[model samples]
Target: METFSIHPIGYVRERDGSKVLEVLPEYRPALDKLDEWGHVVSVWWFSGSDNPDTRSILRQTRPHQSSPGEAGTFATRSPRRPNPLGLTVAKIDRVDVEQGLVVIDRHDALPDTPLLDIKPYSPGSDRVEAPILPEWAAHWPKSREESAVFDWAKEDGKA
Candidate 1:
């Protein structure tokens, strides 16, 4: 198998440290004009799951309690998939270009999550007027704003 290398441009600091995307000093210049947009699509790596065993996991039993049962890695957003990569569209609250810090709304990623890339969210292309989802998840919040009060733990079978 061919191997590839990926270097993170920054890290996601949350909770105790600071809920922000701290761009490395060398990558600070890349944050220019990021504040112009209200949101950004962040590509991050699930570093904690970066292991052979986790990557080899191809199926999981009901990642979501609302789900019917077992699902293939691609069927569910399980961190134990072949690639422990995370993609989220985060709401940009503030951007400090000088300090290379970007404050975003709640994200599933943990503190120190390796940031792969950041792209400005364009509603014209990113938003789908009619998206098809499984029956279990069809009742999810229609927009990110509506998700603020959602009980996520309940959906994950944690509550």
Candidate 2:
């Protein structure tokens, strides 16, 4: 097996007054030019799910009951996987270089989550005009604004 090394550049400080990505003092200068972008794609570790059992799970029944049948780890976005990683595109509310903070409008990552990388979100490369999706998830929110009000529990067959 091949081995690799990775380190976190920062941590998500969710309870320190407000949720924000706080870069390490040494890496603070790295956030020098990230303000021009309206949004950022954050890559972070799913530390909560990084364990032997979760990493060993290669297949399982779908979490959302609405989605039928079993699925391989790669086919689903479940936290339990060989590598517990999370990617989220968050709206950049503000960037304080002095504080090494990048305040985002929203992020699902928990407090102290390790940030792997941050990239400016580019619509040209990230957006798809017409993409295909499973029939069960075809009715999902079309935009972030819509997602705020979308009934997730209902879609997941919990309601």
Could you tell me every candidate's TM-score relative to the true structure? Answer: 0.91, 0.91
Model 1 worst lDDT run, 10 consecutive residues: 150-159
True lDDT of residue 37, candidate 2? 91
Candidate 1's TM-score reads 0.91
With candidate 2 superimposed using the best TM-score fit, by how many Å does residue 46's alpha carbon deviate from the native?
Answer: 0.6
lDDT of 1 at 126: 95
Shift of residue 56 alpha carbon in model 1, Å: 0.6
lDDT of 2 by residue, 1-159 (tens): 897798999988774456698888888888888999999988999999999999999986765666767768787778889989998888888899888899988787898899999889999999888888788778888877798788777755234
The whole-model C-alpha lDDT of candidate 1 against the native structure comes to 0.87
Top-lDDT structure, candidate number: 1
Error of 1 at 55 (Å): 0.4
